[model samples]
Target: MNAINSQKKHVFFRRVSTAGQDIITQEAADLPFREKLSDDEILIINEIATSANKKAIKERPEMQRLISLVKDKKVHSIYAFDRSRLFRDFYEGMEFNDLRAKYDVQVIYTSVGNGNMPASDDVFVEGLLSMFSDIEGKNIARRSREARLRYPAKKFGYQKQKETKRFLHDSSKSKGVQQYFAALKEISSLDDLYKVTKEYRKKLKKTDEQLVSMATDPFYAGYDLEKGTNKLQHVTPYISIEEFLQLQRVNGEFFKAFLERKKSLMCQNIYTPCCGYCRKPLFYKIEEESNSSYYSCSSKLHPKVTVSFSDLSKIIGGILSEIIQNFNAEKLINQSINCYRTIKKHLEAEMDSIDQNLNGIIEELVLGSDDYSADWKQDPMYKRKQLLKQEYHNCLEQIKENQNALQKNKSVIKVIEEALINQSNMNPSMLCDMLINGIWIYGDNLQVDVFYFDYLQEMEKEMIFEGEDIA
Candidate 1:
């Protein structure tokens, strides 16, 4: 026994999913006879690494440490209960083979092929076994995903029955669920619903997303995945499927209108301008009853100031009127030409730089090491190539936007001149949209920024240049 133990050295690597402590212990105890080795051949019982609930070999820290031992020539052989217990992917099998060849180490399985060494036939069999394991793992994942989409038995208001695997509503939880649906039906507006939710939130401790899911998920109305429809009569439902659908339709319309109004009121080209004092964009507010909107300073640290839509429109109109009345066609034309030239130069330089970076990445990808094919999916060079491609597309989009803006700027004077010809036809909203870019309000004072095409182009170029420098 002493001679055999001294001549043969081995390390036991055990891994299992949950509730595997007993299985691992039993395997370790039976290792000597199972692998035909003496009991003294066990290198270190205390040092045996066990990873629980880690299905992937690469994701397991303990397994990585064990692999490091093999790399450092600290272990002669690795013993596991079976090959499936060691790896669930073919790539992992290839990696293990590479490690074995590189470090002159061996892996022996107690149950698989009754412990075989690395040879042509053994390698082929191992590859086949790994493929089977990978397929089995994928099948299990697909089954789990399908089960979720089909059953989705576990829910907030219901408990799953152990014996039957059926869902039944808990009386205590069902009451809250019923009350929540009742409130949804009773509320006339989103504001009222929010207020009711706040009261319920004290006890429910549900997040906004969970509350939304509760309101929208068809399960509450007794959804059957097999039929892909709500079977309200099939199971005892808290709310009728018809009522649930009606609520969704109504709320969905309300949400859509709310978003549209928000977009219009907070339009970046017209609304987003810094406060004169605080240099921060004003926060928007709407009075539901009056339908009057106002933009006010948001900072609590700064003195409060509010400006109505009417006042802002008047201020911006006066500024546009002045610019139109004091029109300078030749000066504006020269300015536009100069700005276009500068922008063209900067854009061409940026495009050239992006092209160089992209070519470098492509060159590295083509001339990468022999193992690049195996590792390229996770390689840094591949990630850089994807990022550079995205950046190149973004630059192209910016160039397009800048050219369109230049054309719009050249036509601004014509638009304003025509509006001034018929002074009565000049609408505040129309004028604001046509000429004004943004308006800033400070106490009683207002700052109106009229969009001169040349100035806008130069600002955009500077912004893009600064962003590129930062990147």
Candidate 2:
């Protein structure tokens, strides 16, 4: 159907696939919706992974915009190629349906019929269709899993059968792996192995998985054996299969445990893309008493620019206080006033009637005898108790919301102030996420580039334009 007022109504489309499939490709495979809307009308297409549950929807930045438009009823209709494109899981599908039905939103399947489609399909039918679709999707997934299990064992660590052996054993590609193992064999202690490997990994920028995989894979020993596939190659082995398996058994266990630990630390710490020193994208660490964790230099672990965890935490706390102090109290108060005005506008008509009746009752009481309890007790003004209670509740809610907003603004102010203070003690971990854009640490010095602090500093120039006096 032709979309009237298309320029004003927003439209959204999404494709969910883990294989990095773009809308262009997906559209080629399956037809997209036909829209007679203007080219200027806003259309958003998000690429998401279907394997990841609906919770993963938050990762797509466009999802938030879609949710806002739905919530505000700014978008009159949402169109997808099919129901699966909208949602695959039953619960997530129900959520999408609820949004459409509750908001009077139209969900149109682009590949299906246009406005001619039945309006009487009903929610229950939609729900049943979605459930069947989910079951079908799960069946397809099971078939794919079975197909993957049928791949040759020789291709396990070597390469996919679809991919060539030349790609796997390419001399240049295997050089780093070969060198790492050669070095590993030369090492006598775990410390030396760690140090050497750490330096090598830094130079290679290899992920933990790649590094661990290279260390454990027996495919390099003329036998390709991994979780799903195993095979034997006619080529000469780099190491015996027995030896390779033994080393993998021992080292694989260690590496797996190490990865778990690394993941845990990452979750606990605030690792920023910005360097603390030099405002570059690097982080350092200072591992003092074995158990204590702190950020140090990116240049080297033993760089003199290192700051202890205690010192970093203290500096951050002090900066936080300073930031809080600099908050624009006048601005916050004005925001509260605006909130109060909005609420007052909503209640003004009711309040006016209440005031008129109240005044009339007061005048009547004055004119009547002091013992005129019967008239006062049966008054129409007394019946306004429920309306007054509603008004009181609305006022209270607005006030609470305004206070919460003010509190949030104050917190941001605090973070800004703490960032500016040149404190000796700062917990690089705690303040790093809040204040730091990047930290660059070199041999003997460190530089911290704080985006929030820098932005506030820039705003200081605006005061002059506004004819505001500086303190």
Report the error of model 1 at residue 6, Å.
12
TM per prediction: 0.44, 0.48
TM-score of 1: 0.44
Task: Estimate, for each residue in 257-363, the C-alpha lDDT of model 2 and write its tens digit.
Answer: 55565565555445543344354444545331142456644554344455544444444444444444454545655665677667656666656666666666566
Output the number of the TM-score-best candidate. 2
Model 2 misplaced stretches (Cα beyond 4 Å): 1-55, 61-79, 108-128, 131-167, 182-189, 202-209, 217-229, 232-241, 260-283, 286-305, 310-471
**Candidate 2: what lDDT?**
0.55
For model 2, state the Cα shift of residue 356 in Å.
26
Full-model lDDT, candidate 1: 0.64
